[model samples]
Target: MASSSAATRELQKELEGKANDLSKIQKDISKNHQVRKKYTIQLGENELVLKELDLLSEDANVYKLIGPVLVKQDLAEANANVRKRIEYISAELKRLDSTLQDMEEKQNSKKEAIYKLQQRIQSLQAGKAKA
Candidate 1:
């Protein structure tokens, strides 16, 4: 219906102030504005483009009618990728914490051993003085 690129110009013009009902319009402007030429064109005096609000999620708002195609995507796959990254980072942090704990225990033991040895040497010196 609104497939003609010409209507895109009209739609853009009309959608300017109606942002209350169209919350995703800001994102569309950011994501689609760059490739506007590739996706949009002038049909007579009207300019329009078929936009897939989100190619990766397709949780989209059809703003302009491009050529006759609706781009739908697999959101599950994207979500999986994010989850994997988070898990990897969390594991790495846990490993670092363990290593730090081990180092701290080793340092504590060394200090304690030095203190005990010093006490033994002091007692031996006092006995030699008495002799």
Candidate 2:
């Protein structure tokens, strides 16, 4: 009976730890998803800007906004920068999505472990009570 009680306590401790880990992982996943959404939106906006820039004449005045300054830049340079930014955002989105998938799988596995531990704890407690 004493051994059973000790085992139950240990399992409870492990359960608590797993639960904490699961919570932290879930929060990280949520944050990653939000960041991915932001990047996706930025990619779309950048693509739209690129399209508009393509429509403009080669000699059209293009100014890039620096910190508190509008720096004059060639249309081609500005277009190149926007295209690069779109590419970067798309890549980041892909990376974040893969990371999120891995985290979710870990979270699910932790949940399953927690469920199993809880069941074992319950059975131990029941046996202890009967004894």
Q: Provide the TM-score for each candidate, comma-separated.
A: 0.36, 0.97
In model 1, pairs of residues that clash are: 5-47, 5-48, 6-46, 6-47, 8-48, 9-47, 50-66
**Can you tell me which runs of candidate 2 are displaced by over 4 Å?**
none
In angstroms, the error of model 1 at 114 is 1.3
Please identify model 1 stretches exceeding 4 Å from their true place: 1-79
Alpha carbon lDDT of each predicted model: 0.42, 0.92
Best by lDDT: 2
Go through the candidates in order and give the clash count of each: 7, 0
lDDT of 2 by residue, 56-111 (tens): 99889999889999999999999999999988998898899899999999999999
